[model samples]
Structure formats: C-alpha cells, structure tokens
Target chain A: MVTYIWVFFVIVGSFFTIFTGNVEALNNEILKGGADGLKLLSEMLPLLVLWTGIMQVAEDSKILELFSNLVRPFLCKLFPSLPKNHPALGYIASNICANALGLGSAATPFGLKAMECLQEDNPCKDTATEAMITFLVLNTGGVTIVPTTVIALRLMHGSANPSEIIITSILATLCSNVSGLIYDYFKRRKKHG
Target chain B: MANFLVPIFVLGIILYAFKQKVNIYESFLVGAKDGLVTTFKIAPAVIAMVFATNIFLNSHFLDFVFSYFTPFLEAVGIPNSILPMAMVRPISGTASLAIMSNIFELYGPDSFVGRLASNLQGCTDTTIYVLALYFSSIKVTKTKHALSAGLFADFVGIVAAFIITFLFFG
Candidate 1:
C-alpha cells in the first residue's frame, strides 16, 4: 500500500513538474529530498534515544505495569478480542498513555511492542487483525492533551500566548478520536453481523 | 504548563524506579540502544517517506489544487494559507510541522491562521507514516482496514481542527 503511494508521488510529481516547466526545480527537489530525510533523521535521533531510555526505565521499574494496570479495564473494553490480561494490552496502554502526554517518540516503541505481541497471537502472519486495526485507528487519532511541541514551537516563534492552542487541540483531538472510534465500531459490527 | 510535564514525568519515572529497586542507568542504556537500533530499522522507511513526500509537495500540485478552493475556504472562515498544511499533514509530520512553523513565523502564533495551524498539527498523527512504520515493523503487508480508518480519522481531525479553531479563535 505504501509502496504504491510512494511510487505515485515520485512518478506523478515528476510528470507534473515536467509539464509545468519546473523540471529543473524538480531535479533540485529530488536531490534535496534525500538530504531532507537525513535532516529529519538527525532531528528525531536524540529525542528517540532519550525517550526510549526513559521508557526502558519505566518498563524495568514496573512503572509500565502500574500504568497499564490503571488503564487495563478501559483498554479491555476497547480491544475485546484480546484476553483480559494480555501483555499487548499493557503495551497498548503504555502507548496510549505516552501519546496522551504528547510523548510521541516514547509511544512508538510501545506501539511496536504491542504490534509484536499481537502478531504472536495472529493466525495470519501477513494480515492485520481487527484488534490491530482498532489500535491503529486510536493511535492515528492521536488524542494529545498538552501538544507540548506545538506550544514550544509557538513560544519559539514569539507567540504572546503560546499555550492558547492547548485547549482547542484537546477538544479537536477528542472529537477526532470519538468519531474515529465510532466509525471503527460500526465497521467492526458490520463485519461480524 | 506544558513545560513542566516532561520534567515531572521524568522525575516520576526516576522515583518509581528507585522504589522498585531498578537500576535506572542500565535499563536506560539498554532502552537507548534499542532505540538506536529501532531508528536504523525505520530509517529506510522514513527516508523513503520524506523523499517521496518532498517530491510531491515540491511539485506544487497541492498549491495548484488549493488555489481553486481559496475563496471558498476564506468564505468559510478558514485561511487559505493553511490548506497545504492540512492536506499533507496525514502523509508527513515533518512537512506539516515545517508548514506550521512557517505559518507561525509569518503570521505570529496568536493569529487565527496560526492557531488553526497549531490545532491541525496537534489533531492527528501522520497516518501514512505511522501505518508504514508499524506495519513494516511487524511485517504485516496486508493492512486490512487500518489505512482507510486511519485516513478517516485524519479527515475528521482536519475538519475538527478547522471548525474548532474558528469557534475558538475566529
């Protein structure tokens, strides 16, 4: 799926640029594209390292166990396919908690771990399960509470009220999450019913 | 308020680790090393995403497409400047962030456009990127309903961002 999209972008973009007589600019952009990837990697590297380390501590200290236990009931309701005390639920809870706190980089490892756990139980190795899809929906909806990065960017850009968007962000994310979950619920029902 | 969250979180982790008799330093190193490996694992996908997204964005196709919607957006109280950000947001996080920071620099963060940009940025994760990374990590090539559902969420999030921004900051 991503393969098709990736190819579409490169092929269609190049063709469009050629037709628009921006072929030279497109040439420059294609080169810059790879460099931009490296730039992004550099930017994400430190944050990923720091958060994963902290998350590792949380895991070792059983902090994740505590956190997951706190959210387990709710997660069980959301992911009924999984067993009540499944390890994936713990990872999923940790992922959601990290996302809520706006620790996106920290959330990735937990999410990946959750996926790995889900895969362990998946009968079909190549296909995603209903539980996996539901988790993806929730993860993509994001449901961030603080939006720390946005606030920080605003502050850096000299906004008079850097955190003003926080409330709106939370509200908007809630709306997205609700709508996404509702959609997923109905779709799942249709599949089973 | 947002500033204290990370510090407090770290402190909480440290205190909890101490009480649990966990060697925080060793655990952290182990996790950090895993993180570096994860980074490498995802680097190829990330690079491909960035490269392709940049090519598409640089093609200015979105700009061309959005030009037609400018007047309608303005009429609906949405700023024309943010359309591109909203469009590419689900595809690439860094691209949207760059657009958002540009909006911040140009209009200042207190402006309506700025607030909308911030809300858009916060409302969702990069759906395509997340799907690619997570699925690839597990080697799940058949994504089933995940992509459609994730994009649906992003669509709703974008609309919610626009509407909520207007209600709050318009």
Candidate 2:
C-alpha cells in the first residue's frame, strides 16, 4: 500500500511532466527534495528531543505510570488488544494529549515510542499490530482544535476573524476522527469473526 | 495561552519527576539519545516521501486535473482556488500550507476561500507522511490497513471541511 502511493506519485508525476514539457521542474524538485526533507527533520528535531527527554523523566519517575493509569480505562476501550499495563499505553496517551493540544511535533516522539513499545510485543515483527493501526488512525484522524499555525497564518494575512473557522474545523475533525474510528472498529471486528 | 502550555507542561513534568526522586538529567539524556536514534531511523522514509511528493507537486498534476474541475466546482459555489490545498493536504503538510499561504495572498485570508483553507488545514493531517514515518521508524513494512484507514479519514475530513466551511462561512 505504501509502495503503491509512492509509485503513483513518481510514475504519474513523471508521466504528466514528460507530456507537459516541465521536466526541468520535476528534475529540480527531485534534486532538492532530499534537502527539503532534511530541513523539515531539523525543524522538528528540537521538539522531539526536548519532549522525549522531558517525557523520559516522567517515565522513570513513575509519573508516566500514574498518567497512563489515569487514562488507562479510556485507552483500553480504544486499544482492546493491548494489555492494560503495557508501557505503550503510556506513550499512546501522551501522544494523544500532545496531538489534542495541536503540538504535532511534540506528538511524534511519543507516537514513535509507542510504536517501538508495540513492536516489542508484535508477533510478526514485520506487520503492524491491531493496536498500532488504531493508534495511527487516532493520530492521523485526531482532533486539532486549536490549529495554532493555521490561525497564526490567518492572522499574519491580516484576517479580521482569524479564529472564526475554529468551530468549523473542530466539527470537521470530529467527523473525520469518528468515521476513522468506526472504520477501524469494523475492520477489527471482521478480522475476529 | 498556547505559548504558556509548552513551558508549563515541561516545567510541570520536571517538577513532578523531581518530587518522585527521578534523576531528571540522566533520564532526559537517555531519552534524548534515543530521540537521536529515532530521528536517523526515520530519515530515509521522510526523504523518500518528500522526494515523491515534491516531484508530484512540481509536475503540476493535481493542478492540471483540478483545472478541469474548476468551472464545475465554481458553478456549485465551491472555490476552485482551494482545490490544490485539499488534494495535497493528505500528501504533504508543507505543500498544503504553502498552498494555503498562496490562497491568503491571492484571495485574502478573510475571504471565503481563506476561511475554507483554514478549516481544511485543521481538518485532517498528512496521512501518507505520518504513516510512512511511523511505520518505517519501527521497520514495519507490512502496514496492513493503516494507510487505507488513514486515507479514508482524510477523505472524510476533506468532505466534512467543505461542508462545514460552506455552511458556516460561505
């Protein structure tokens, strides 16, 4: 599935570029894309390092255990396959909290940690576990109520009502997250049956 | 308000850890070291995705396809200016953001199109990038239904954004 998406991008993009006589643009993007990726990684590096470090303190102090236990019931419902006491549950809760606060960069480290923890118990080592899929769905489909960047961009552009779309955005994300969770639920149910 | 959240959250965690007698500095260093390792592990996946998405965007494929829908979309009161942002939203966050900024430049951010862009930006995430990075970091090649489910959420989010934006701001 991932391979198909990448192939579609490269193939169709090149296919169109060849016909449009825009090969130079494509060539330039191809050459510069790696650097851009590095730039993005660097932009995110500080947040990842800082939060993971801070969260690690939480982990070691049993603070993480307390936090996870607070949300464990809610998480258990969302991730039925994971054990109640799994360490991944702690990271997962932390990831969801960061994501909800609209700190996407802060969320990635926790999500990665959760994935690593999940992988520890994964039977196949190569395939994704059910809990991982559900976590990804929640991460990708989760609420971003603040949309701090979007609001900031709107304000930068001198919008009179920069935050007016907040309600609408929240509604839309709720739709997405609910629908994604429903789809994930049915997918899990079918597999079990 | 949001600015305070980050520092407060960090400070609160440290205080909590200190109260619990955890060696904050060592714990942080250990985790930060793993953070470095995680970053390098996901670097290849990020580069691969950025290359593909950049090439695709540079080729103007979505723009070309969207041009044909512009008139039809406008006829139905949809702003064609936002089509690029919507289509690119799930593929690349930077691209979608660039497109949103462009929309703000062209149509003014308070315009219907701009508000819609804001809503769209907040509606869904970069599914492909998120999936690739998370899965690849853990070396999970067989992602099963993760991609499909994420994309489905993106699709629904896009539709919901359009509907909610029009109803509220249109």
Q: Count the backbone clashes (under 3 Å) in each candidate.
A: 0, 0
Could you give the interface RMSD of each candidate, to one decimal? 2.1, 1.2
- Candidate 1 lDDT over residue span A1-193, tens digit each: 7788789998988888998999899989877788888888788778778877988898899888888889888888899899887878878987887799888877887787788889999999999998999999999899798788898999899988888888999988988888888888888999899
Question: Model 1 over residues B1-170: C-alpha lDDT tens digits?
Answer: 65677799899999999998998999999989977887787788778888888888888888888999989988987667798999888987778999999998888899889999999999999888889888877778888778888888888898999889889878
> Tens-digit lDDT track for model 2 on A71-152?
9999999999988999999999998888877888888999999999999999999899999999999999867978889989
lDDT of 1 at B100: 95
Rate residue A174 of model 1 by lDDT: 86
lDDT of 2 by residue, B1-170 (tens): 88898889888889998888888899999989888888888888888888888788888889888999988998987677688888899888888999999999999998888888898899988888889889889888898889889889989999999888778877
lDDT of 1 at B39: 76
Q: Tell me the TM-score of model 1.
A: 0.91
Best of the candidates, DockQ? 2
In model 2, which residue pairs have backbone atoms overlapping below 3 Å?
none
What is the CAPRI rating of model 1's predicted complex? medium
Using TM-score as the measure, the top candidate is: 2
Q: How far is B125's C-alpha from truth in model 2 (Å)?
A: 0.6
Model-by-model lDDT, in order? 0.87, 0.88
